[model samples]
Target: MTAILKTEHLSHRYASTWAIRDINIEIAQSGIVGLLGSNGAGKSTTMNIICGVLNQTEGNVFINGIDLRKNPEEAKKQIGFLPQNPPLYTDLTIDEYLTFCAHLRLIEKNKIRSAVEEAKERCSLGHFSTRLIKNLSGGYRQRVGIAQAIIHKPKLVVMDEPTNGLDPNQLIEARKLIRDIAIEHSVLLSSHILSEINLLCKEIIMIESGRMVFSDSMDAFNNYVQSKAILLRMDNPPAKTEIVKVPGVTQVDVLSEKQYRVYFDGSPEEVTDRLITASVEQGWKIKEIGPDKGLLDDVFKQLSSQSPQ
Candidate 1:
């Protein structure tokens, strides 16, 4: 697949502290790419640099092979961004605000009205098109921001925390809108909501404390997590001490009075037999044995917390 955006060893700083460093990322064309991390994890920083909102102190950014530092105008023309806070003029009606956006993009005057109307319709803002932005709900405000982002029909869209404060219904609508736009435009979206990222993105890039940890498809991430689990469900519960002491097992948790989850730090090859022997030796009956979901969550937590070395 073609790359819509590429960064080579991108680095950025705030005074003496670096927000992200030596990061390389490739965003595939016309797909949803997620930048997933906790707040202060450098996701927003990366997005800002890519959009030319912030100049990287080092490294290169290529939007469709146009180096941002070399041709900012042409590079920026290919991107539309929805910031965490939608920059709407609350006093202006949706139509009026969208018109202003069209003008900023240098759209031809004759087609501006029709274009704004089309954008409003696409975001389902037809009914509220004449209402002041302040009168719109938080969700509607976001739609207005999205409408403005795409008013120029850019090839790539970058959104920062797009669904931060939405109700369930609004979240659904926002997701649908993202899906609709993604069919024609590549998107780099940021969110702490892992589920939303998992559902919408074909690829996920994670950053922490100003560094890229890893980036891969969902299947690869799942496989990495699964390989870390040593599924252990016993026919009967064993003593907590024994369960914890079993070779290779790192931790234990009671699933129920009759069930327990065992975690292993080493290979799972001998864990099943070891668990069975430990149970039988102690006069405990073995029940069903399988890895637990918490195991994967633990693995993810461990990996995500460690700065990339």
Candidate 2:
């Protein structure tokens, strides 16, 4: 099957400097795929080129078997985009705004109302159809933004930081809505948050310094960053020297008076068990103990080092 989206040597350059270089991506299935990168890492540039908002300096983008450059309008019919800041007309009612979007997407004149209603229903905005966009809360406004993106039922939806700025409850609702959207549309969700990607995506594509550094299944990415250390919190913590004395222990980092991160060369299970035994014997009350996955920056640094310079 042809990829819902594909890029070959995708690159873009600003007058004297390259914004991105030789990036390639392919997605053929219907599910959420994460585009992970830090700020200024060429994520927006790549998305712009793929969505036809900006022309790439050198590369090709194919949307569902159609060449984006050669047949942009037709290719774009298969795509939808919601940028970080949604474009919404505050004065327009939800119904009015969505109807306007349906027209923009070139939905049939007679079918526009049903199309609008379907989008509203899909995003759970049907009840707010007559409410002015400005009157709705931020989360509801976000739903409006999403409603517009899928108004025409595009084959692919590209969301940039879709859950950004949402409150905890809103985030839960938004994530669920995104998952529902993915059931029928391929979603390319982009975010710098590692936990967000882990929660929503089955596949991961990571870019850094304007180049592709990693692309694979989410499980594969997790396994690649296997934990080599365990974090411990205790009511009466042992000294760093005591932790170091444990068999197979390589190092111990004192995080706080009650917290420590122990590094060991042996299996985490074995080492953690030993630490538990030591804690019981030494009267150290163990509060928390688990593998430390390290920080996102650590993963980036490790992957960057492995990438060809």
Candidate 3:
């Protein structure tokens, strides 16, 4: 499928320092793609450029095959953007606010009402249409922000930190809303929350110090760090030397008196069976054992540490 959004050699500069350099990304016609980075990692700068809020010093942005630089107005019409802090009029009622947004997006005057209603329903705001924007909870206000964004039915929705500042329940609701938005329009969202990204995004693009470090499907990202490592807990843990003596054991990390992280070569199942047999024969009471899928935090740390300043 053709990409709904694409950026090539995308770079931005602020006087002397480059905020983002030679960044490239592509999004398919549907699915949620995550943009991840630490603070000052240029995620905001990159999103701003893609949304046409900021012009790049170099490189190009294309939306639905329309060159953004040459045809900004046309390109922008195909995008729906929700910034970290949503742009909203506090005094306006939900109904009034969404109607205004519909008109602002140039929807036909005769069709604006239906468009606003549809957006409201999609964002689960059917009951709060008459409520004042400032009177709703944070989650409802976010729904209003999303309602305005999709009122015009743009091809791609770009949300920056959509789940920020929400309680646990609110976060769950927000995540569902985002997934609903992705059903019809492709999504590109920036987030620092790795677990949120892991749950929502089918693909991830990670940058550090303004440079691309990782970009791939979530499955591939997970598989990238797959290793023959196991977490073990025993009532009578053996010395590291005894554990290393087991065939296929390459390394061992003693996490605590009762726990260790063992690394090995060869099939995990076979190695695990061997270890179990040895533990039983040596009278080491096994408490627990499981494969250790390396953590996402570890991967992020490794990548970020390697990125140039």
Candidate 4:
């Protein structure tokens, strides 16, 4: 599939400091790509550059084959950007604000009404059209922002922390809108909320210290979970030495007197049999045995730790 957006050796700097460097990326035209990074990890900087709000110090961003570097106006016409705070006119009614967005995007004069209607309905703003933006709840306000974004039907939407400050219901509604858009438009979602990203994104791009660390589809990321970690809970103390010496068992840490985290990077059958034998032999009373590192938390920890990989 042709990428809706592609970046080659993307780099940026802030005067004397580097914000991102040597980054290459391609985003499918219809997928939710989560930009995952902790605060100060350069996610917003990258998003800003991609949206053409800031110029990249190095490399290029291509939108639908037009290089943002050489033809930013044309390239940006294919993108819709929603920063953390949606640019809203408090005094304007939802209809008026959406119309303004459409006109600014240069939507044909005759098509603006239908375009605005489609956006309003898509973002669930139909019921609030005549209400001043200030009269709407935060959730409705956000919907108006999204409504404006798609008023022009841009091929891709880049949102920074779309769910920030939203309550549960609002978040759910926002997520649904995002997923709906992804069926037809590429979405580059930036958020520090891991749980939200894990639930909403099909792929994840993680960066650290201005460089890409991990970038892959969610399925591939789950497959990359090393089998070396295991979580086991028992009612009794187990023989640690014997378990550690088993083939493929690398290290064993007793999280609690009853819980043991084993490092198992071997065949499942072999490891299971050994664990069973060890449990029976030592009366370890094994209650659970499974691969760990399902959460990106542990992986993040190991990657951030001083320990050598």
1-309 per-residue lDDT for model 4 (tens digits): 667989998989898999988777798668799998788988999999999999999998999888898998888899999999999999999989988999899999999999999998898888888999999999988888888777888888999999999999998999999999888889999987777888899898877778887888866655555555777787776577867887778888878888888877768667878887878887878888776644566665544442221
The lDDT for every candidate, in the order shown, is 0.85, 0.91, 0.91, 0.84
Residue lDDT tens for model 3, 1-309: 667999999999999999999999998678899999998899999999999999999999999989999999899889999999999998999999999998889899999999999999999999988889999999999999988889999999999999999999999999999999999999998998788898899899998999999999877776666556888899998898999998999999998889999999998888899899989999778889987644677777877888464
Comparing 1 with 3 on lDDT, the higher-scoring candidate is 3
Q: Candidate 1 on 44-90: residue-level lDDT in tens?
A: 99999999999999999998888999999998889899999999999
* Model 1 clashing-pair count: 10
lDDT of 2 by residue, 158-220 (tens): 999999999999999999999999999999999988889989999999988899999999878
Choose the strongest candidate by TM-score: 2
The TM-score of predicted model 1 comes to 0.79
TM-scores of the models, in the given order?
A: 0.79, 0.86, 0.83, 0.79
Q: Which stretches of candidate 1 lie over 4 Å from their true place?
A: 227-296
Q: In model 4, where do residues sit more than 4 Å from their true spots? A: 227-294, 304-309
RMSD in Å for candidate 2, one decimal?
A: 3.4
Error of 4 at 217 (Å): 1.2
In model 2, the Cα lDDT at residue 47 comes to 92
